[model samples]
Each structure stands twice: as C-alpha cells, then as structure tokens.
Target: MSSFAGVSVLDDGMLCPSTMTFVSTSSDCGYHLLVVKGYARTKETPNGQSILSHDFGVGGYRWSIKYYPNGIISDRADVVSLYVHRLDDDDGKHVEAKFSFSFVDEVEWQNPVYIRGMKTCSFSSDASSWGFYKFMKIDALERLMNLDKDDCFTIRCDIMVCNAENDAGGTQVLLPDIHRNLNNLLHNKVGADVTFEVGSDIFSAHRCVLAAQSKVFMAQLFGPMKEGSASLDVIQIKDMEATTFKALLSFIYTDSFPDMKEDEMSQATEEEAVKYEMWRQWLQNLLVAADRYDVQRLKYICEKELCKNMCVSSVASMLVLAEQHHCHRLKEACLKFIQVQSPSCLQTIIASKGWQHIIATYPSVLNELIAKVIASNQQLVLK
Candidate 1:
C-alpha cells in the first residue's frame, strides 16, 4: 500500500509486475558521507580533542557536542564523528540535514529486526530511511589488517541525503576575542618593587620582559628613570617626546619596529661610541626586541636596512647582535658582507679589534679570508 511497494498490472492473458525505480530521495538530504571515529581517554577529558591525529586531511562537517544525543549514553565517549551532509533545500528552500552515528559492532539486530539490506524504515520506524549495510569488526579487523590498537574502532558511512550540494568550501571557524583571556596575565604580578640596576642596553631588558606579560608594561614605565632630570613623574613617561618615546613605545606595545632616524646616535659620547663601535646600536636593539616578540617580519625589515648600509665596522656589531640573539639569517648576511668587501676594508675591521670576534664566530670563513690575505700579502698587507 506504501509508495515503496510494487504496482501490479493485469493483462488479458497473463499477470505482470512493475515497480518505481529508486528515485534517490537520499541525495536531497545533502549528506555526502559520515565518518565516526572512537577513542578512550584517561578519565573523560582529552587534549587536542583529536581521536585520529595520524589520519589528517580527511575532512567532513565537524562539531563537538558534549554528549551523544537521544539520552543513549551516560558519560562522555570521547567519540568524535565527522558528518559529510549534503547541502539541500527543504520546503522548496535550502536547509542542512542533521545526521549522527549509532555506534554498534553487529551488522544485524535480532528481535528488534535491525539487519543489513533491509530498508531502514521497515526495520525501525523511529530511524531514518538509510541504515547500515556492512559489518566491520574493528578490533578483530585491526589484528587482521595489522593496524595499531589505538587506531582500531573507526566506522564510516557513505551517506545519501536529499537536496545536497556538491561544492563545500572549507574554512576554519575561529573562536572570538581570545585576547581577553590573557588580560589577567598581563596585569597581575606578585613581587615587591625591588630596586634593580637597569642596564642601558635595551635588548637585554627587552628579553626579560618578553618572558612574562606582567613585566612588559612595567619595563616600559622605567625607561627614562635612569636619566635623572629627563623624567620626574612615574606615570608621565607615556607622554614623553613623540619621536624617540614613540619608537620605544612601539617596542613595548608590539615589540620591535622602532623609527630609525639620523639623530639616533647624536647624544652618545665619543668614547662610548667607540666601545659599542657603531652608531646603529639602537637599530640593532630593535631587531633583538622584534625577535623576542616573534615579530619576524619586523626583524627582517631591520636586517634589510642594516645590510643595505653595510660597513666593515658596522658589520661586526651586526654579527655580534645576530650571534647573541640567534638571528642566523642576519649573521649569514654579515659574514657575506665581510667576505665581499673586507678585502679592501680589512684593515678597518682589524684596527678596531673586530676580526678576532669574527674569526671566533665564523672560523671557516675567517680561515679562507686569512689564507687569501697571506696569498696577496705582498700587495695587500701594508705592515
């Protein structure tokens, strides 16, 4: 009597049978495939929340619900399933079909009459029209197939739903406003304000602050305190000189990316300049600060500038900064500059005691250059 049943025809001489061809009503549901992978955790919670981490790139509609629906299970199963539902329209309009898995080892149900090949509607009126057609003994199958025990019980179904679409663009749905989660971490500190002898080296202090969020803002407050009359108010450092202070504040707020100008080294005494040996120390400090914050793009920008203005004396300072901060790319650039131009400017670096550090840091390149120098000792050496 149902539409799925056969229709009979009576002829004058004999009886004949006819039936409706499967119209694929399932495709209308928009479910392409469903994969259910199961796993056990220590208690109930797990990290990474991934059951099948090894098998990546297999994607479907993924959602993490606390418990299985239908009130069938008591505790969290740690069973995650991906439902590949087709995009379909219901009531002559677009809608998404909801599909879930029923984890069972047996292919057929007895007494209740759940069985493979039986139209799912006939066996269980409560269930959907499509049901299981195959039995995969996952645990037993794992041994037979020689798979890891941890990877055993995974079941997949090629789903057929009505009104499903073919193309589904993948996108990651990021959780909103996650930065607010670290607000307490940035503001909370437990220790007393002990007097610490701060160094003039910006890069050194930048490293300490980067290790903890609480110290970052605190370190910014004390920047001008070392210069006695330069600052008076504890809180007024925020409104200090627009140019130099903004560059310093840039490092505090985002780490690195200080504005470099011609006047950056004008105030330094002649003796201290010789010790640091470069007027570009502030720029070098910015590179270090950028590295601490993992601001890689800013770090590259500073390095590019240093390489563009490469000089024998400046190259040594950059090499030291690169080595101290593990900036391998910058260190390589410094070595290449020395190899290319140091033949003519070799005495400039040697006079400044820069060659010793270069030789110590990059022994192989130093050896090759030294040999080249000896080979042309008559012409190049002016001892």
Candidate 2:
C-alpha cells in the first residue's frame, strides 16, 4: 500500500452514498468525476484477472477504469491493480489529468482511501491507458470492504484536461495593403484639405492626418487655444523649411521615412554635393521640428542618421544639437566618439568654433564631460 502525507479528508456531502462532486478551479482546467460501485463482489470471469467500469466523459473524451481484485503483476501479488483507459481513439492527441481513486467507508461515511497525482498520457494505436499495477494492498481493500454496508464501494476520478484542441475558436483578420494605400495617399495628396506656406513654397496636406499623428498639430488645429487663422484654409509656418516640413508630413502619413539612394554622396558631382548638403541640412532642421512637435519616432530616426554621419568636425555641433533637443542617445554617441574613437578628436572638437558656444549655452554638458573623464581615469588607476 502507498502512504500519503498532508492529505485532507472532506467530511461534508463529498462522501455521500450515490453522489460526489469534483470542481476544477483553474480557468484553463476542466473537471470530471467518475464513481465506481460494488467493492468486494465485482464480477470476474474464470480466466480474467481484471474488470472494467462503465465509461465516462471528461473534456469531450471517453474514459474508463480497470480494476484488478488480486494483482496484475507477479511481484505485486499482495496488492490490487488499477488503471484508467481512454475508450475513444485520441488519434495522436495528448491529455493531462490530476486524478484520485478512493475507497469510501460505509461505517464512518467520511474517511476514504485516496490515490491521486498529476499525470500526462498520450494516445496511440499500441497502448491507450496508464496507472499503477500495485494500487493498494489486497488486505487493506478487504478490511475496507468488510466495513461497507452491502459489499459496495465508491471510487472517484477527478480529471483536469489541459491543452485541448479547438478549446478557443475564432477567425483572425489581417490587413496586408494598408501601408501601400497610406503611402499613396500621402505622396499623391489625392484629398488634400489644408495648405501650408513656408517662405515662398506651398504644400498641400490633410489637417486630420496631421492632427492624428501629433499632439502639437492637434492643439494648433482643434484645441481650445487654437490660432485664429488655423480654422482658415491656408496656415503659414515660420522658421521651418518647405523640404523639412514635407518630410515630417510624409512620416505622419506613412509611419516611415521616404526611401533615398545610399550612394548619392559617394558619386556626387559639385551640383549633386550641393543638393546632398541641402538634404543633410534639411534632416537637421527636421530633427529639431520633430522634437518641438513631440513626434518621437521621427526624432529617433533623425538621431540614428546623425549618429551614423558623426565626424570630428560635426561632433561638437551634434553635441550642441543633442543638448538643445534633449536627444540622449545622440549626446552619448557624440561623447563616446570624442573619448574612445580617437583621443585627438576631443582636442579637435574643443578647438571648433561651436565649442565656445556649447560652453556658453550648456554648462551642464561640460560638467557631464568632466565627470566622464574623471570616472575613466579612476578606472585606469584601479586596473
């Protein structure tokens, strides 16, 4: 016989003569209670060693219990054998369960023998059942049978099925053409509702699209303190380039940057160089505009591009821009390039014309640079 520790017996309506209840508390667990009757006088054929109970349903599957009164194995001759069998064809399906086989006492009607544990069983054409060959001692079963009223006993199997197929059923919807449609709308300006005049250049765009993408646009266009001419058809923007504003509108509509040739600078003539320089300046202005308008993704893309183009001459200017616009990654990259990439890069940056402007404008940035230098020296001394 097996011994149990820390097992609690239920004395309420749990051990009734004809009824028992099993409940699964887990949201993903399913419950089933199987009851077996007739303890001592279970019918056995002359040559058969075990008897099968009536089949029960649990989680859309049929199951049955097989009991051996004597013993199924030679080594476990002194104990009774018990097994749970899957009656239906699982067809490669797997079932998990926590079950208990109990022998209810008739005299007390409360105390019972319980054999319970969590188990995982897989179904195959070869074998479809799992259990213990030595379930309980034959002497213990006989003593329990003697205490019963009409040579009857009851056993309960509590099953919790997990990972069942088709448990959650629904159709999923997907949109594959959304990006292309939005990009076309942005580039074509098919249904333009607003026009922005920047210097001598004018661009047509949708106000709703801008308002949806940016809180600053929303406030300027629809909030309580909106500008007087914002309700008009044309709104003029000052201190921003037409090209930079166009790029910002493209990002708002398409949620991505417009594609550009990577080798434009490498193959540039004098005219192409001027055009590339204008585009680079536009990107810097767009970065400042993105931060002012609270467009974080645009700011992130600008920071990444600036970090990629970092040179000794541009590092100081990039640091000033990072400090002014609160771009932490770009600021850290500029410092790292100055300190680690080349020691001479620092002197070169300090000698730049923007270095005096940086000290006059951002004293905190100078403090941070000094702190990094001190920390680096301390690490070198310790090593």
Go through the candidates in order and give the C-alpha RMSD of each one to the true structure: 24.4, 24.8
The weakest ten consecutive residues by lDDT in model 2 span: 1-10
Candidate 1 has a TM-score of: 0.30
> Which residue runs of candidate 2 sit more than 4 Å off their true CA positions?
1-176, 227-231, 266-279, 341-344
Q: Which runs of model 1 end up more than 4 angstroms from their true locations? A: 1-249, 252-256, 262-279, 292-295, 361-383
Model 2 has an lDDT value of: 0.62
Best by lDDT: 2
lDDT of 1 by residue, 1-383 (tens): 00111111222211222311212221222211112222222123332222211111111222111222111112222222222222221223222222333323434312121211111111112321222111222232345334454432323232221122233633232222222223222234223232222232121123234334334343443444234444322223222233343344344433323433333333357865554334366567666655654555556666755654557767776776777777776776776666567455867766655567766776665665566656666566665
lDDT of 1 at 382: 68
TM-scores for every candidate against the unseen true structure: 0.30, 0.51
